[model samples]
Target: MDQGGAPPVFSVTAEGDDDRVHVAVTGEVDMATADTMFQTALREPTRALTLDLRAVTFFDSAAIHAVVRLSQRFPATLTVLPSAQVRRVLEVSGLGEQDWLAGR
Candidate 1:
């Protein structure tokens, strides 16, 4: 839920086995929901993790920090598929060239 009128829709779903897990994030991902998203993504502790953020509509700095923390935790095992919105932020943050980013 955001600070505005209607509560913003936010969800984090993870699938696949411990070998490789995929997490899809949708809706607004701000300070309010970033920690939940981070925890959800770590639930499985897979050898490899792919974050599908193509459906995310809003991504704040907190969200980016969460992603960075995940990347640090997983290191070589982390991969991210960023939406246009997320990608723009990553680029601005100088993280766009990270190897963890998929589809460039």
Candidate 2:
């Protein structure tokens, strides 16, 4: 569900079973909303997790940090579908080549 202000600058939704969960994130992901994104994505237990950030508009260092921490939790099971905004940061942060990133 969306958890943000009036216009809802951020929203996160998760679906799938315990074996495979898909989390779709939309809107901006900055310092204020990064932790919420991380926590919401992990609200469900799963052996495999996919984070879809294609709709994110503003991705910052805090968001990248959150993604990294989330990946660490899932490691071999984590997959990230990053948007242009997120990809840019990942590339500059030297994490764009991570195995967890899809559609590289």
Candidate 3:
């Protein structure tokens, strides 16, 4: 679901099962939508969680922060699938290659 935000915010689709939860995100992600993403991503209970950012067109520091926070909270359960552009930002933010970002 796309949580309404200021402008150019992102949409999130969350799918969950017995062992895992998957969230696919599209559009831009920034301060306007970071909290929404965080809330939506953590709304379910699962042994594993995957964040799919393949369709994201823009990612900023706030998006990076959201990923970091989720990683911290979920520990071994969180995974992030970032696009090339988002991967670059994650790398610059010192998180792209982290094991915590490994996707299922």
Where does model 2 exceed 4 Å of error?
A: 1-7
Clashing pairs in 3: none
Tens digit of lDDT per residue, candidate 3, span 42-95? 888777889998888899999888998988877888888888788888888887
TM-score of each: 0.89, 0.90, 0.84
The C-alpha lDDT values of all candidates are 0.90, 0.90, 0.83
Estimate the lDDT of model 1.
Answer: 0.90
In angstroms, give how far residue 56 of model 1 lies from its true place.
0.6
lDDT of 1 by residue, 1-104 (tens): 45776544798999999699999998889999999999998898688899999888889999999999999888898999999999998999999999999877
Tens-digit lDDT track for model 2 on 20-67? 889999999999999998998889888989999999988999999999
* Model 3, C-alpha of 63: deviation from truth (Å): 0.7
Rank by TM-score, highest first: 2, 1, 3
Better of 1 and 3 by lDDT: 1
Write down the RMSD of candidate 3 (Cα, Å). Answer: 4.7
Better of 2 and 3 by TM-score: 2
**Models, CA RMSD each:** 3.4, 3.7, 4.7
Instruction: Tell me how many residue pairs clash in candidate 2.
Output: 0
